[model samples]
Target: MDDRHSRQSWLEAGLSQLAARGADGLSIVAVARELGVTKGSFYWHFRDLKDYRGALLQQWEAQYTQLAIERMEADGGSALDKLRRMLSLPAAGAERLGLALRSWALSDKEVARTLKRVDARRTAYLAGLYTQLGLDAARARTLAQFTYHALNGRFLLGDMVPAAAQLDLLLTLLTAPNDEAVAETAV
Candidate 1:
């Protein structure tokens, strides 16, 4: 096999390593081995491990977060439609990568900062979609938080994820207008 891997290949192998063994799997040696090359090959692609990790995070954000949002925006659907399409993304794989990144964040400040930015961006995007659905600013932000957290939590739940019927009900609650009010009897 050819040993001279491109920078993209290094990033891709790093992602695979991250997914397979969490943050601990992201060392230069491990990624080099994954690419069937020596650790020295990593220097040709990255200045150091910090640089490599930064590039990996950048690649992750560009591909998984930015591209998905771009496509959904281009699709031009209703808020609920776009939300459903976007929400389906977490369920379509990449859970391991996300979990690994989060795990890495626990012990690394840079990773934590990057993860925080990514999460906030994703949550803001969800809030934007919810706002488009006619929710007030506060309500939209709150529901977006719930929906975003729940989507991530669903992965952590493994087989404990709610049934389709249960999820449909939650979806309705999320998408429906919250204008219903109880009649005041004492006032």
Candidate 2:
């Protein structure tokens, strides 16, 4: 009787479990039970709980960050269009998983470091997009920081997300004729 699931299945189930119940749901036995399999099945898929967790972190970064950036870059659109699409991605179900990771980061140093690095990578990408729209490097980076912070804050604050038109206006300010004009208008 082959009760063993594939490694990908194991990793995916772990992510779902984490998203559903935070890091407490990450135990090997818990995930095995959720999958209707025995704890031995987890051992077959990963070396141990630590190995499983490392795999999960890698999978999360790849699926949520790297692949997302790749898909956005592949699209034929202006920087503003890509920014709009990027902001809208949480609607596609990455939010809960991402929030779960953020929650987990609060308690785990390793996760905190990974989250920071991932965020910097994302912010740098945003800065590049803003720069493409003709903003100076310093201004572009500042806008990226605000955009990144607002996006994450919205993820946490739920009902506080700005409407589509507001987001469009914000993106438009990045391309305004004067640096001080964009800065003053934002405030």
Candidate 3:
């Protein structure tokens, strides 16, 4: 492979290993073996293991966060609809990503911190979006935070709890209204 493609292949191998095992198990030799290359080739692409990790974190965060931000911004719909879609994405892609990162976070502080920062930014943006949709500012922010935790938890527990069913329960809880809405609808 060419230099650029070789580097990308190394990265892909590292990430695949990360997903299968955890970040703690990631190693230059392992990556090299996976890619059918010598460990020396890994050095040609990255300065060191840390450099490889930094690059991986940057790419994962930027790509995932940008896609999420774009989805939040592009759709012209009820905030609830947007929220539902956002919450629903886990079964598709985000959940798998979150699960892998969460496992990494348990052992790697740098990865954990980076993931936390990215997650906070996304949550804050969602909170702002929620506030625009007739929800009280505090309630909106709380719900936004809850959504992140819920997604993380649900996906982590996916082997035991069905994703669709868990998402439905979460959606119902988040969208349920206050006493006034209840009384007002009581004809």
Give the per-residue lDDT of model 2 (tens digit) for 1-187.
4534778878888998888888877788778877888888888778988888889999888887898799899985998899887776554456688889998899888889889989999999999999888889998898899988888777766635457987777666855758677787788
Better of 2 and 3 by lDDT: 2
Backbone clash count for every predicted candidate, in the order shown: 0, 0, 0
For residues 1-187, write the lDDT of model 3, one tens digit per residue.
6653387787767777776666777898888878777898888879998999988887778767876688667876877677767776645444656677887788889888998899888898778767766678788889888877766676776633447776566555565566575455443
lDDT digits (tens) for residues 79-104 of candidate 1: 88887665555455577788889988
| Regions of candidate 1 where Cα sits further than 4 Å from its true position | 1-4, 159-167, 179-187
Between candidates 1 and 2, the one scoring higher on TM-score is 2
Worst lDDT run of 10 residues, candidate 3, spans 178-187
All candidates: CA RMSD in angstroms?
Answer: 4.1, 2.7, 3.8
Off by over 4 Å in 2: 1-4, 159-162, 183-187
Runs in model 3 deviating more than 4 A are 1-4, 92-100, 159-178, 182-187
* Top-scoring candidate (TM-score): 2
Q: After TM-score superposition, what is the CA distance of residue 106 in candidate 1 from its true location, in Å?
A: 1.4
Model 1: colliding residue pairs: none
